[model samples]
Target: MAESATALAIMGMALVTYLTRVGGLFLAGRLPTGRRWRAALTAMPGVILVSLVAPLVLGAGVAEAMGAMVVLALARRVALPVVVVAGIVVVAVGRAWLTG
Candidate 1:
């Protein structure tokens, strides 16, 4: 009974949120909003990426994580592969340091 009630509540919340998003799109047609709003919406992903990456790059409040982030930035020429290698190195070193 409790589980069913919780599931119902969750579904209700999701339905409401979906409706809100659809409503926003519907209302956008009526609004006199400009290109700036569209541009800002388009930049949302970049904004989110920076927000997510910035803290991780600066520090994980851990030295290994910090070092890996710096090296990742330095290896911009081979960004994807360098990031993968840096991540592996940071994890290996961090694990070793923590365990030993």
Candidate 2:
């Protein structure tokens, strides 16, 4: 594609993303803050995370699988940064061990 086309595409994507976020916030503010709604909203992040990660995990190699497992274990008991670091370390080590 031409440079101008690429730039236009990027701008379009950014606009779409910005609009989606703004629309979500706007709708959320208008939604009922009942217990069920609040619980669902609170769980939305985890649901989204799993939806994103599930495909990668299912298609992953042993090293990636090990890393995902490490992340899962740490996720329940530790902060996100720690879980991320541990997952990276586990994947790297597992890959090295497998290759060596």
Candidate 3:
């Protein structure tokens, strides 16, 4: 694609992202602030994370499975940053060991 077309595509994506964020904020402001809603909102991140990771875990090879196991084991004990780094390292090392 031409430079102008690429720039336009990027701008379009940015606009869409910004609009979605604004729409979410607008919707959130209108939502009920009840206890059930609060609880659901609190759990939303974990639910979303599982939804995203479930597919990868189900389809993964040994290396990815092992990495996911490590992450799960450390999730409650360690901070998120630690868990993330450990997961990445585990997957990288496992892949190397398996394929080497």
In the range 4-60, model 1's lDDT, one tens digit per residue, is 999999999999999998997788678656898888877978998989877865665
In order, candidate lDDTs are 0.76, 0.90, 0.92
Candidate 2, pairs of clashing residues: none
Top candidate on TM-score is 3
TM-scores of the candidates are: 0.51, 0.62, 0.66
Candidate 3 segments exceeding 4 Å error: 31-43, 78-82
Alpha-carbon error at 52 in model 3, in Å? Answer: 2.6
lDDT of 1 at 2: 95
lDDT score at residue 52, model 3, on the 0-100 scale: 98
Poorest 10 consecutive residues by lDDT, candidate 2 = 53-62
- The C-alpha RMSD in Å for every predicted model, in order, reads 4.1, 3.6, 3.3
In candidate 2, what are the lDDT values of residues 1-100, reduced to their tens digit?
Answer: 6999999999999999999989987888889999999999999999999899887875878999989888888888998998999999998999899999
Q: Which structure is stronger by TM-score: 1 or 3?
A: 3
Model 3: pairs clashing at backbone N, Cα or C within 3 Å: none
Off by over 4 Å in 1: 16-42, 64-71, 79-82, 98-100
